[model samples]
Target chain A: MKRYAPYIIVVLLALLPFSGLSTYMMHIIILMIMWSVIGMAWNLLGGYCGQVSFGHAAFFGVGAYTAGILYFKLGISAWWGIPLSVVVLALEALVIGFICLRLRGPFFALATLAMGEVLRVTAENLRDFTQGTLGILIKERTWVEKTWYYYIILAIAVLTYIVVKKIIESKLGYYFVAIREDQDAAESLGINTTLYKTIALVISAVLTGLAGAFYTNYMGYIDPEVVFALHDISIITIMIVMVGGVATYWGPVVGAGIMVVLAEWIRSLPRIGTAHQTLFGVLLILIIIFLPNGVVGDFSKIKRALGFGRKV
Target chain B: MTPLLEIKRVSRFFGGLAAVMDVSFNVNKGEIVGLIGPNGAGKTTLFNVINGFYKPSRGDILFKGQRISGLKPHRICRLGIARTFQVVKPLQRMTVLDNVVASAFLRSDSKREAVKKAEEILEFTGLSSEKDKISKGLPLGMRKRLEIARALATEPELLLLDESFAGLNPTELVQSIEVIKKIKERGITILIIEHHMKVIMSISDRVVVLNYGEKIAEGTPEEVSRDPLVIEAYLGEAPAA
Candidate 1:
C-alpha cells in the first residue's frame, strides 16, 4: 500500500489535461509540464549526480538548433527532428560531459557557463544555417489545438518522470546519490563514479534537448537566446529543486510549481522590474535558511513525526 | 594459511618525500591484522595504496594470488575489496537504511530485495532501531556502525577499515569489537588501522608496526609490543602506554 502511493499520485497528475481545463489555461499547464520535465532532467544530473551545471542552456540550444536546421535544410517535420535532436544533443552532451563533468561545484558551474556562452555565440554567428539570430521560423502544425499541445506535453512529462524515477530507483540512481553524497565512498562500493556521472549527464541532456525541440516547435520560433536562454535552461528548474529539496524525488515538482506559478502570477501583470526574481530570491532565502527540507521534505518529516517510517 | 593479501616494495612519493616507502606485509584469510603507526607514519596512505585509492609511485599489490595494482577503486571493489573511511562518509541526505542499501546495490538489482537485505544487515549490526533516521543525525558511534554496515553490504571477502574506533566510547568500542569478531566469523578477512592499542591487542590475530612509512616489526601483538623499534617507533622510550 505504501509503495503504491507514488504511482497513484502520478496517475492523478497524468489525468489532469483530460479533466478539461480551458484552452489558454491548458497551454500554460502544458508550459508548466514542459518546464517540470526539463527541470526534472536537470535534477537527475545536477541534483542527483551532484555536478551542478549552470549552463544547461548549451544542451537545450543544441537540441533546438538540430531540429531547426533539419527543418530548414532537409524539410523534416519537428516530429522527425525529435529523435534527431535527441541524438545530436546527446552526443554533444557526452563530449561536454567528458571535458566538463570532471570538475565539481563552482568550477563545474563555470565550465557549463562558458560552454553556454560559446554555444550562444556560435548560434549568433552561424547565419546561413541557423538564420543568424533572426531564428528559425517554424510553421504551425496541422493540429494546432491548444488541447493537443497540453496532452502531448503531459504525456512526455509523465514519461520523463517515470524514466528519471526508474533510474533513481535502480542500481544506477543509487550510484548517482552515492556519488553525490561522497565520491570516494561510492567508489569503494564498486560504483564507477565517473562513468555513472557521465551517463546521468547524457540521459539528462537528451531529455532536456527533446524538451527544447518540443518547445521550439510549440512556440513557433527558435532564436538562440529565447529558446536556449539560461532562463529556460533548467536554471529555474535547479532553483526549483533547491527550494523544493535538492535530491528528493518530489523536490523538482514542488520547486517547479512554486517558482513557475509565482512567476506566472507576476508575468500575468504589467511590467515589473526584478519583481519575479526578487520574490524568487526572498522565497529562496527563506527556504534555504528555514524550510530547507522543502515542501515534500516536510511530508517525509511529518510521516516520521507521525511514527510512520520510524522503528519505534 | 598462505598470504591472502600482500604489498611488495610499495613506495609512494609526493614530490620527493616518500609518504610510504618500500613498505611490505601479508595478511592471511580470516585474520584481523592491526596496522599501527605514529602520527605522520602514513598508515592511511598505505591503506589507500593497497585498496587502489592511490596508485603507488612504485610497487605491486596482490590479493588471493592475483596482481591488483593500478586498478580503479571500483574495479578493485568488484574484485571483492571493500573499505570504510577514517571520517565516515554516510550519505547524510539519505536515511540510515539508504546508506546500507546504496552499498547493497553493488550486489543486487531489486530494490525490495536489496532493501530487505539492508534491513537485516542493520538488524544484524544492531542498527535496525535507527533504520529510518537521517544518517547525519546519528551519533559518532552509530555513524561508525553505519560505515561498518555499508562495508558489510558489499559482501566483501576482504574489508579494510580506517580508524573505526577513533572516537568511540568504551561501551561502543567493546560493542564494535564484538561486531568485527562476528564479521570475521563469517569468513571475511579484516585489516584495520587503529590508534586504540587495547582494541588492537585484544582483537588482532597478528600486528604490524610501522614508523616513518617503514615496517618496523611484525608478529603477535605481545611480541610486536615488546620490540625495541616498535617501542621507539610508536612509544617514545617508555615502552609502556
Candidate 2:
C-alpha cells in the first residue's frame, strides 16, 4: 500500500481536471503544485544538506527575469525561458554558494536573505534593464485556458519529486545526511562537504528557477517586489517545508497544499482578508511551539496527542 | 624499513601558544605505537596534525614517504590515513550499519560492496547485534566500537585511535584491547592516543611520552614506563628535590 501511494496520487490528480472544476479551482491547484516545487527545491538544500537558505527568491527572481527579459528584449516566445533559465540560475547559484556556503547556521541564512534583498533593490534601480519596478508584461500568454498551465506544472512537480527521491536514496543522499548530522565526521569519512553542499545548492537553485520561469509565463506579469519579496518568496518557501515536514518526502507537498488553501480561504473572507498573514504568523508560531520538527516529522506525536494510537 | 607514517618536528600553534611543539615520531608498518601524555599534553593535537586536520606550523608529515602536510582531511583519508575522534562522533540519527556503510563508500563505489564491507567491519568490531540501532542511542562502549567500525570501513593502511578506551568499563576495556589486537592482526599500523597507562603498556609495541607539547621519552613500553623523565612529567618533578 505504501509503495503504491505515489502512483495512486498521480492517477487521482491526473483525473481531477475531468471533474469539471471551476477555473479558479484549477488556479489553486496549479499554485499548490508550483509552491510544492519550490518547497521541494528548498528541502534538498535546507532539509537534507542542513544549509538553510533565506535567499531562494534570488534564484526565483533571476529565473523569472530570464524569461521576462528574453520576451521583453528579444521578442521571443517566453516558453524559451523555461530551458534558458536553468543556465542563468545555475550561474547565480554558483556565485551564491561560493559566498554563503562558507558560513553556517543562521549566518548562512542571513547572507541569503541579504542576497535576496540586494537583488530586489538592484531590479528596482536598474530602470532600463528590469524596467525599474515598472515590471514586465508578457502581453500574450501561451494558453487562454488554465488546463494547459495546470498540466505543465503537474508534470514539473512529478519530475522534481522523482529527481529528489532518487537523489535521497543514492550515495549522494547519504553524504548529505552525514553532513547534516555532523560535518566534521562527514569530512573524516572522506566526504567533501563543500563540494557536496554546492551540488545541493545548484540543483536546488535550478529547480526553484524553473518554477519561477513557469510563474512568469503563467501569471503574464511580474514586478521585482512580487518576485523577490523576502517574506513572500523566501520565507514562505521555508515555512512550507517547515509546516509540512523538515526532512520527510511528503512534507512539502502537504505543507504547500495546506498553505495555499488556507491562504485562498482567508483571502475570500471579506472582513478578515487583510488578516491572512496574521493567521499564517499564528500558525507558524503554533507549529514551532508544538511541533518543532514540522508536521510530517512529528506525525507520531500528533497522532498520540489526538488519541489515535495505542498507548506506549 | 621506511615508516608507514612519519611526523618530523611537527608543531601546531594557536596564536602565540604552541599546542604541539616540534614533536617527531614514526610508526613502522604493522606495529601498535602508543602515545601517552597527561591532560593537555598535546597528544590529540599531534594526531590532528598527522591526519591533516591542522597544518603543522613548522614541520612536515609523511605517509608512506609522500609529504601530506597541507592536504585536506578527506584527501588524507582517501590516501589511506583514517583517525577517530577523541570524543566519539557518530552520525547520530543514522543506524550503526548505515554509519559504517557511509565510511565504507569511500573505498567501494558499489553500494552493495560498501554494505558488505560495512557488515564485515560491524561483525569484526562486535557491533553486529546493534547494527540496526541508532548510533546516538548506543552506550559509550558500543559507540566507541562504532567509531572503530567506521574507521576500519575506510580500509586505512594506518588507523589512528584517539582515546578509544577513554570511557570504557573494565570488561569493555578488555574487549576494546582485544579488538585493537585483531585490527593489528589485519596488518594495519596503529598510532593510538590513550590515557590509561595499563592498557597502553600492555598493547603498545613502543611508547612515546609527551609533556607540555614536547616529546619526553620514546622506547619500548617497559623502557618508557621506567624512564625518570616520564615519571617526572606524570608525577611532577619529585617535589622539587
Candidate 3:
C-alpha cells in the first residue's frame, strides 16, 4: 500500500481538473505543486546533505531569468527556458557550491543568503539584459486556461518527487547522510565529502531552477524583486521543509501543501489580509516550538498529544 | 618483504610545539602491533598522519611500496587503509546497519552488496541485534565496536585502531580483544594504540613505546615491558635501586 501511494495520489491529482474547480482554485493548486518542487529541492541539500542554503533564490531567479531572457532577447518561446535552465542551473550550482560549500553550518547558510542578494542586485543593475527593476513582461500567456499550466507543473513535481526518492534510497543517499552525520568520519571511510556535497547542490539547484522557469511562463511577469526574492523564494523554501520534515521524503510535499494553503487563506482574510505574514510568522514559531521535527516528523507526538491511538 | 606501512622520520608541528617529532616504525603484514605511551606522547597524532588526517611535517609514509604521504584521507582509505577514531565518531542519526553500509560503499557501488557486507560486519562485531538501533544512544562499548564495524566495512588491508579498548568495562574489553584477534585471523595488519598494559602485553605481536614525541623502544611485549626507557616513560625514574 505504501509503495503504491504515490501513484494513487498522482492519479487522483490528474483527475482533479475534471472536477471543474474555479480558476482561482486551480491557481492555488498550481502554486502548491510548484512550492512542493522547490521544497524537495531544498530538502536535498539542507535536510539530507546537511548543507542548509539561504541563497536558493539565486538558482530560482537564474532559472526564471533564463526563460525570461530567451523570450525577451532571443525572440524564442519562453517555454524553451525549461529545457535550457537545466544546463544553465547546473553551471550556476557548480559556481555557487564552489564558493559556498567551503564554509560549514551557519556560515554556509549566510554565504548562500548573500549569494541570493548579490544575484538580485546583479539582475537589477543589468538594465539592458534584465530590464533592471522594470522587469520582464510576457505580453501573451501561452494558454488561455490554467489546465495546461496545472498539468505541466504537476508533471515537474512528479519527476522531482521520483528523482529525490531514488537518490535518497540509493548509495548516494547513504553517502549524503554520512556526510551530514560526520564529515570527518565520512572522509575517513573514503566518501569524498566535498564531491558529494557538490553533487547534492547541483541536483537541488537544477530542480529549483525548473520551478523558476515554470514560474516565468505561468505568471507572465517577473522582476528582480519578484523571482530573486530572499524572503519570498529562499526563506519560503526553507520554511516548507521545516514545517514538513527535514530528512523524511514526504516532509517537503506535506510542508508545501500546508504552507501554500495557509499563505493563501491568511491573505484572503478581510481586515487582517495585510498582516498575513505576521500571523504566519506566529504560526511558524508555534510549530517550531511544539514540533521541532515538523508535522510528518512529529506525527506520533501529535497523535499522542491529540489523544489518538492511546492504549488507555 | 617490504613493510605494509612505513613511517620514516615523520613529524607534525603545531606552531612552535612538536606534537610528533622524528617518530618512525614499521608494521609488517598481518601483525597486531601495539603502540603504547603515556598521555600526550603523540600516539593519536601518529595515527592521524598515517591515515592522512594531518600531513607529516617531515619524512614519508609509504603503503604497499607506494608514496601516500600527501594524499587526502578519503584517497588513502581508497588505497586500503582505514582507521577508527580515539573518540568514536558514529553516524549518530543512522541505524547501526546503515552506518556500516555507508562505509561498505567504499568497496562496492551496489547498495545491496553494501548492505549484505554491512550485515556480515554487524554480525562479526556482535552488533547484529542492535543493528536496527540508531547509533546516537548506543552505550560506549557498543559505539566503540560500531566504529570498528564501520571501518571494517571498507575492507582495509591495514587497519589503524586508536584506543579501541578504551573506556570499556572488563567484559567489553575482553570482547574487543577477541574481535581484534578475529580481525588478525582474517590476515589484515593491525596497528593499535592502547593504554591498558595487560591487554597490550596479552594480544600484541610486538610493541612500540613512545615518550614525549619520539620512539623510545620497539620489541616484543616482554622485551618492551622490560626496557628501562619504556618503564621510566610509564613509571618515572628509580632514585636508588
Candidate 4:
C-alpha cells in the first residue's frame, strides 16, 4: 500500500490546477516546478560531481533568448525554439565545460563564473541580436497556448526528472561520484574525470536551457538583465540542492519547492518586497549551518511521513 | 614472459629537488615486487611516474612493451595499470559499491554488468556486507578493502599499490594479505609500496630498496632481507636479523 505513496502525491499535485485553484496559486505552483527543474539541472554537476557552478543564469538566459530570437526574428514556433535552445546550450556548455572542467576545486567555480559574465556582457552589448537588454516581447502566445504552457512545462519537468534519474543510476553517475570524491584517485582508476565532469555540465546546461526557453515564452518576454542576473548563480542553485540534500535524486526537488514557496510567501507579506531577498539569504545561511546534509537526508522519516518506501 | 611494467632511468624533478632520479626497475608478469624505502625516499614519487600521475622528466617507461612514460593517468589505467593513493582517497560521498563500480565503468560498457562485477569484487575484497554503506562512514580497514575492490574492477593486469596495509589490525592485516595472495593467484602482477617488512618480505617475489630518490638494492626477498644496504637505508645500520 505504501509503495503507491509517491504516485498518490504526484496525482494529488497534478490535479491541483484542476481543483478550481486561484490563478495566483497556479502561478506559484508553476513557478515552484520551474525552480525545481532548474535546481535539479544544477544538481547533476553541482551535486553529483561536486563541481559547484555559479553561472547557470547565463545558460538560462542564453536559452531564453535563443528561443525568443528564433520566434520573433525567424518566425519559428517555441516547439522548434525550445529544442534549438537546448542544442545551443548543450554545445556552448560543451565548449565552456571542456575549458572550465579542467580546473579543479574553486577554480572550476571561478572559471564558470567568468564564462557566465562573458555571456552576460555579450548579451547586453550585442544589441543587434539580444536587443541590448531591453528585451523582446512576443506579439502573441505561441500556442493554443495558455493551457498548453502547463502541460509543456510539466512534460519538460518529467523529461528532466527521468534524464537526471537515468544519469544517477548509470555508470556515468558512478564516474561522477568518483570524480567528486577524489579526482586524482578516480583518474588513477581509469575513470576519466575530465570527460565525465564536462558531460555532466553539458547535460545540466541542456536541461536548464530548455527550462529557460519554456519560462520566457510562458511569461511572454525575454530580457538579458532579468535572465542573466548573477543572483541566479549556482549559489542559489546550491542552496536548493544543499538544503534538500546534495547527491540525492529528489533532493533538489524538495529544496527548490520549499525555497520557491518560501520566497513567494515572503513576497506575500506587506512591505516585504525589498526585504524578501535578505530574508531568503538569512534563512539560507541558517539552514546551511544547521541542516548541512539537508532536510531530506532522513529518507526513512520522510518516507514514513509520506507513507512510501518501507517501514520507518 | 615480457615484463608487465618497465621503468628505465625515469626521473622526476620538482624544481631543484629530484623526487625520483634515475629510477629503473622491471615488474614481470604475475610477479609481486616490493618497493621499500625510508620516509621521503621518493618511492611514492617513482610509483607516481609509473602510474602516469607525474610525467618523468627523462627516460622511458614501457608497459607491455609500449612506452607510457607521459601518457595520461586514465589512459595508462586503460592500458591495464591501476594504483591506490597512499592517502587513501575514497570517494567520500559515494557508497562502497559505487566506488568500485566507478572503476568498473572504465572497462565495462553497461551499468548492470559493471555493478554485477563490482558486487563480486566487493565480496572478493570482503566488503560485500557493507555494500550499501557510504565509503566515508566506513572504517579504515574497510576503506582499504574498498580501494582494492575499486582497483580490481578496472580489470588491471598490473596494480601499483601505495601503502595497502597502513591502518589495519593484525586480523585485518592477515585478511588483507590473504586477499592480496588470492589476487596474485588470479595472475595479476603487483607492485606494492609498503612499510611492513614482514608482509612484503613474505609476499614479494622480488624487492627493490630506495634511499634519497635512488635505488640502493634489488634482489630476491631473502637476499634483500639480508642486504646490508637495505638495512642501512632503513636503519642507518645493519639489522641483527
What is candidate 3's DockQ? Answer: 0.91
Q: After superposition, how far is residue B151 of candidate 2 from its true place, in Å?
A: 1.2
Q: Candidate 4 lDDT (Cα, whole model)?
A: 0.84
Task: Please name the candidate that would achieve the greatest DockQ relative to the true structure.
Answer: 3
For candidate 2, the docking band is high
RMSD of each: 3.6, 1.3, 1.3, 2.9
Worst 10 residues of 1 chain B by lDDT: B232-241
lDDT of 1 by residue, B41-144 (tens): 98899988888889999988999889998998899888888999998899988899999998898888688888988998998889999999999999999999
In candidate 1 the C-alpha lDDT for residue A227 amounts to: 62
DockQ measured for candidate 2: 0.84
Best by lDDT: 3
Q: List the residue pairs that clash in candidate 1.
A: none
Candidate 4's residue-wise lDDT over B28-62, tens digit each?
99999999999999989998888888899998999
In the predicted model 3, the residue pairs found to clash are none
Per-residue lDDT over A1-312 for candidate 3, one digit per residue giving the tens place of the 0 to 100 score: 998998899999999999999999999999999999999999999999999999899999999999999999998999999999999999999999999998999999999999999999999999999999999998888998999999999999999999999999998999999999999999999999889999999999999999999999999999999999998899989999999989988899999999999888888899898887788678789888999999999988888888884654
The lDDT-based order of candidates, best leading, equals: 3, 2, 4, 1
lDDT of 2 by residue, A237-259 (tens): 99999999998899999999999
TM-score of each: 0.92, 0.98, 0.98, 0.94
lDDT tens digits, residues B1-241, model 2?
A: 7899889999999999989999898999999999998999999999888888888999999999999999989999999989899899999989999999989989987889999999999999999999999998999999998999999999999999999999899999999999999999999999999999999999999999998899999999989989999999988788755
Candidate 4 ranges with C-alpha deviation above 4 Å? A1-10, A143-145, A299-312, B237-241
Candidate 3 or 1, higher DockQ: 3
